[model samples]
Target: MKYQFDKDFLWGVATASYQIEGAYDQDGRIPSIWDTFSKTPGNTYMGHNGDEACDHYNKFKEDIALLKKLGIKAYRFSISWPRIFKDGKYKLNEKGLKFYKDLVEELKKNDIKPIATLYHWDLPQILQDEGGWSNPEIIKYFVHYASVMFNALGDDVEQWITFNETSVFLYLGYLYGIHAPGIKNLDLTLKAIHNVHLAHGETVKLFKNSNYKNQIGITLNLSPNYPYSVEEKDIIAAKTNDAFWNRMFLDPILKGSYPEEILNNPFGNTLKEIIKDDDMEIISHPIDFLGINYYSRSVIKHDENETFKYKSIPQDGEKTSMGWEVYPDGLRVLLNYIKENYGNIPLYITENGAAYEDKLENGKIHDIDRINYLKRHFISAKKAIDEGVNLKGYYVWSFMDNYEWAEGYVKRFGLTYIDYETKQRILKDSAKWYSQVIKNNFIEE
Candidate 1:
């Protein structure tokens, strides 16, 4: 094993509001899209909802204790918009505010850096009533919401992410109808993407204008797309997939414009109309760092009649419990691509991990597959750093097993497995392995 990371590289784990922080109805917190969608019949798998996910809301201190025990240097978590603003307005939810305040303080007390995310796909139901991201009004609301958190916790938290995977939210929620506020409308999906970019721009502007002492960035789930074949058609399919999945968000934020390929497509003009003057400047505001969430590489082929004209094919390799391919090199490829395309901005692996169905026996979860998945990817990350990619941190996808959205509780992506029925948490073998990595700042054979 090599000590390739910087001495101060962040080691941590991440969790979202709707996925882990239950108490959905308590403390003046209003319903979010997840709350509404999960409650609706036949929406979530097996009629499951995150009504009491991991009970993190009530046990954050204990959770932080686990992070301390794991020797993690940072913790990235999302702030529930509906919890902070029951109606998406300034009427403060004292209890909701206090919850996060205390959580941050606890992390700080344990010498753990806190990375706060403003939104993680948990839009307040009130905002959803008014077209959600499809309406431009969300820009102002999101800015205000960001301001509130900045004013409340900026002193302690030095790393801030505006939106966690906005592309996923728009695509899944609006296009695929898998997540909350599910609606399968292509036109609306495109509109929602534009609105989300605008909202991100507004929030970035707000953070800059406030003179906050912190770094602001966006976390994007980027995959290295591979064409199914070397043929010209397959190559063209790969380019299209990159334009939509990777460049659609990256180009605008990093280059201040949409990818030319996407802008020249049949729906290109529609995207152009949505991009307003000065929007790019707001979106591209000089940030201190960018967060990349890499899971697997995508193998795609062209399909003219198919939506987006690129269909994902299964990879001929090992798979995670979630059925995603295990491709550590994809992480290295994406890291170098960002460095070449987006300049030398510092980057963080804000979310990386695999799901595994591990059965606990004798009071322990011997999840060897997850441990191997993490070790291989961490080596890939080390390779990136050795190759001069200014990588800053690595945070596993989650700390505790909780309600996975859409897939429900079926997919477990945590170091600590949560018995949903008993609310008992058992640390898996991966947790112990990760603890050693964090402690030594390197993996040992």
Candidate 2:
């Protein structure tokens, strides 16, 4: 079977600044939260840091050349906030701006569209010291920084993502203390949640009010929650999980209100204390599209002892290197759910790919597991499109293997394999297969 995508359907790859761009301190780039957290003892795998990650800051031209070779129609990459703001202050960094400008120019030279993500979990450390996302003052700082990018890049970059994976960054950073600026406080997490949404709303307002003609939106790591069984308790537990996991973020931006279930009891009381007048209006401002980073689904079972009265039940299936189960049909179900619940707004699969145990043999990588993962997901996306969902584009999670946050370089999620020691990039079998898919704008199984 061969599934074909429209010519206008963007086929691209996604990457983040901190994950790929090494030169952490070069060219007036200040330290971000990741830098501080990764440097602290017992924070990351082997205490690994991204100080020399792929050296992309020094070899962007080479990387852009690689993108051109892959026949990608678009490239989604992030801009480092610390790189643009000196000492995490309101000062401009021309060198930092120039690097991205050069990168955009190179992508245009290769006829590839540029999609920029404003934030990808690399908050400036100075801001963290001042309470980070938990501080309302950070909203103005974020808007100012975004305004600078709007004035600098403008229409040269068409699609702009206000933030990437807010749930992962906020929950992991504040609630779980696993990612960066490691802090485990539910109070701080609740504050950070409201403030982050306010920040996103303000940025969208600024973009829409600008003279530039372009698109702006947010990317969320959404996992569709399914009940473990048909039991009424399990069903209610799944609904509760949906309220916090999906609706808490989606409702503010798409529906202009928080879930009533969440606002009723337990965590709702804390969230209510921080929300102010017109905050939801700002957070729910209209935008062009929604970017979804779908990886897996959750099976919620009733748990009287667990917080939220629910716990995830592990499903029996093939798992990725990240220990996430491979459930491709979840993508189709998620897309349909978004369309039915949030209105059929334009959508993009901003990040979808799996991490696997990639082995290099004879100067080539035969990552068949990763390839099958992508193929199944792609078909699922096509199914959604056929079912009248407004799915427009698909950007694979990564362009190359780089620093994978707390997991460090152990989990490989890229089509291109990067040699950490030599900084050499080798095209894996999946990359070759993806290149053909991009060229043909279709996939065959």
Candidate 3:
């Protein structure tokens, strides 16, 4: 069966500032937590940092040209905080702001809608030194930075995402010690999660009052949790894991509340200290839409020793180079679940694509695997739309391969293959496939 998305569906590609924009220490931009972490002794793969990644900071014009050629109608990108606040938290570096302004203008000139992400895990080093997102005061700082962006670039942007994957940054940073400002502590992680909710609420309130408003929302990387077995223990564990990862983030924003289990769990005492009474009302501020970043789903099994009493069960199937299982049907199931749970709120597949071990061949990349992966997912998206899910748009994981973080530059997720040494781009077979999808508003098989 062939299907076409609604003509108004948003078709675009996304990239983060730290992942692509090199020139890390130039134009008065100081070190972000990522910059410091990548340079540390044993954080990322091969000691590879994003110092000269994709060189997108300098090559943005060429990149914009790529987007234009792809025929995508939208481009989603993040702004680096250190670039704008070079001196301190409040300092406004015009050069840093101008870079993004110029990017926005160029995007508009090319007929692309600009969707701006306020924070994509690039916290200014100064803020991390001052306790980062763990401190309640950090909420104020985030709101201030958001205000600055709103006043400067908000008018040019049609959509604004306050934070990209709050769960990944907080969970990975606080419990895993893999990401920046590394701190692997359970209590601190709990506290940080609450503060993050507060920061989200505060920022949404600011956007509501701001005059420049087209569409505003948050992007979450969600994995549907299914039980490893039909056993009671596994089912309970799966639900608990869902509550922690999905409900923990969504309930606060959509329902204006948190799961009672999270508040009353073994970590109850720790959560109480940081959680405030008036926080839910603030966090629950209504928004225009929700952005979902889906990659893979997980099968949960009960494990008493694990912190959450749950663990992921490995399965036999096609997996990404990142080792995540590729399950396209999960996309439709998840889309329907969100709508059933959150009431008809507008939704966008903000990020959905896979990373593969790709290499150049003769002037182009024959990435048929990526094309197949996206075809299945796009089919699943059409199913959701047919079932009446209000899926507004779809944006691929990335436009081009750049820094992969933690794994560093080793993994490739871009539809466009990048020649790292020469900073050249080759449109992979997946890119050509995606171009047709955008050009026709339908996935052509």
Candidate 4:
């Protein structure tokens, strides 16, 4: 077996508040968009709501114990906006603040570095009602909330991610109506998208001025666009899609401007009008690092009549339980692509894991498929590192199975399988395998 990766390479697991922290109405917490969306009939799978997902809010100590056992170096989790800002009001909830204050202490006691995400799709319902990410004023609310967290937990948490998967949440929530605060309107979605980046800029500025010696960055779920064929039409489609999805978010932060190709489009032009003076300058503020969540590549073909002027061609290969193609080499390609295009900066595989129909037999989950998925991705990451990609760390998508958004609890994407009935976490086979990878500081291949 060959080994790769620097000795200090980070190994960790990530979880979001809405997905794992059930206790929807406990201890001064208010409802988030997720709570409202999941509870509404026909919004989620089997009417599944995250009312009692993993109960991590009440079981933080036990969860930290699991991280210590796994030998993980870091733990990436999000701060629930609603938890701190009940009903999206300006007032901060002391109990909500206490919960995270205690969680940070527990993580530090276990010698685990904490990566805190300010927003992870759990928007305060009050904010959503007032146009949420769509409203430019929402920046003020986000900045205020971020400031509170920075002052409260900044000393303990050195790494902070402003937003998680900006495109996914906005597209799903505003355009597709599949996620929280569901609303289907392409025009509104476009405005919301641009403003989301603005919010990111505001948060970045807030973190930098906090006077805490900390590293701040934003996490974008980047999808590499590949042409479906050698035809000129396909090639053009791929480029345009790349600008639409990848560049729209990346270019703004790194380059401080939107791609001309994206801004010139009829829809993209609409996004242009929303860009106010000094907005790009604010968004372009230099940050400490960039976290990318890569799942798979998109193979696109030109479509004159279709929205976004491109259509996805079905990928042919082994697919995950989420129907994402199992393409480990794509991870290496994407990592190199980011380094080549975005310049060498510290980058972390903030979220990477696949959903699978896992089963528990004899008090264990024999998820060999998941183990293979992670092993291949790990090797792919190492290949990029060997080629001079400044890849710092990789955090598996989830620590345990919990509410999986629209799919509810059906899709299991965790190394540790959670028995929903008893809230008992059974470490899957992948977890055991990952423990060794962490201990070795490299993937054995």
- Higher-lDDT candidate of 1 and 4: 4
Which candidate, 1 or 3, would have the higher lDDT against the true structure? Answer: 3
Model 1 lDDT per residue over 201-294, tens place = 7778788888887799999999998999998887889988988889999987888888888778877877778777888887777777889999
TM per candidate comes to 0.98, 0.99, 0.98, 0.98
Residues 34-137, candidate 2: write the lDDT tens digits.
99999999999999999999999999999989999999888999999999988676999999989988989899989999999999999999999999999999
Query: lDDT tens digits, residues 245-291, model 3?
Result: 89889998999877887887977678777667898899888888999
Where in model 1 is the C-alpha error above 4 Å? Answer: 1-3
Candidate 3 Cα outliers beyond 4 Å, as residue runs: none
Lowest summed lDDT window (length 10), candidate 3: 267-276
- For candidate 4, write residues 85-150 as lDDT tens digits: 765758879999999999999999999999999999999887788888888888888888888899
User: Is candidate 1 or 2 superior in lDDT?
Assistant: 2
Residue 155 displacement in candidate 4 (angstroms): 2.4
User: What C-alpha root-mean-square deviation, in Å, does candidate 1 show against the real structure?
Assistant: 1.2
Question: How do these models rank on lDDT, best leading?
Answer: 2, 3, 4, 1
Compared with the true structure, model 3 gives a TM-score of 0.98
Candidate 2 minimal-lDDT segment of 10 residues: 265-274
